[model samples]
Target: MEALVLAWPGGEHAFRLPLAQLELLQGATGCGPEFLLNKLNLGQWAATEPFEIIRAGLMGGGMDAAGAKDVVSRAFDRHP
Candidate 1:
């Protein structure tokens, strides 16, 4: 399954999942990230954190999951 990651302003991140997950996520929120996360039982992660990291990645033009995680952690340390 191929996943396309989308990051938007105002702290929004979406994973364009493959057909199966897409079906599930779409049903929950019509192709929105919050809906997908809720449907996939990952709602606990909270959209703000991932979205902030994603926003950073998108702005920098370097999107890597591990790198995003690292950036998120550092951001968390500074802000939290």
Candidate 2:
């Protein structure tokens, strides 16, 4: 899968959805990859889906668990 690099609050970070992350995401959302993607595309996701996806992707992109969680927390806040 391709990595999604974005300019976050502090700096640019790369996020990815590998198999392991995908599986975790599926479990968290109780949906398959296609369904999840569709939901995201259609803007039908639940409140936590985006956060989960970003956290998982950050981990998949080689960020440590704590770092990923911190980044997701900061990025998902009310700021831009």
Candidate 3:
């Protein structure tokens, strides 16, 4: 499933996506934030294979796989 439960409106916060879905997106998304964001944003108008753009953009932005994962992990740790 290419879906994510956005931060809940109020009271409860349930920003979660299935691990399998995330894994699929990870392989497709490469290292950019756009496809991921678009995915989290519902992906209604997203490209068919946005992962290509994600990979290209990540390469252009000079962020490799490890670096991107580090950033995400740090973000979660710092915020939570």
Off by over 4 Å in 3: 1-39, 42-60
lDDT of 1: 0.46
Poorly placed runs, candidate 2 (over 4 Å): none
RMSD of each: 9.2, 1.7, 13.2
Task: Assess the local accuracy of residue 26 in candidate 2 as a C-alpha lDDT between 0 and 100.
Answer: 92
In the range 1-80, model 1's lDDT, one tens digit per residue, is 33445533334444444444334334434446555456447655544544443434333444455655565566566766
Clashing pairs in 1: none
Task: Give the higher-lDDT candidate: 1 or 3.
Answer: 1
Deviation from native of the Cα of residue 8 in model 2, angstroms: 1.3
Predicted structure 2, TM vs. truth: 0.85
Off by over 4 Å in 1: 1-31, 34-61
For model 3, state the Cα shift of residue 78 in Å.
Answer: 0.8
TM-score of 1: 0.31
Candidate 2 collision pairs: none
Per-candidate TM-score against the hidden true structure: 0.31, 0.85, 0.29
lDDT (Cα, tens digit) per residue for candidate 2, span 46-66: 998888888888898889989
Global local distance difference test of model 3 = 0.43
Shift in Å, residue 53, candidate 2: 0.7
**Candidate 1, position 1, lDDT:** 33
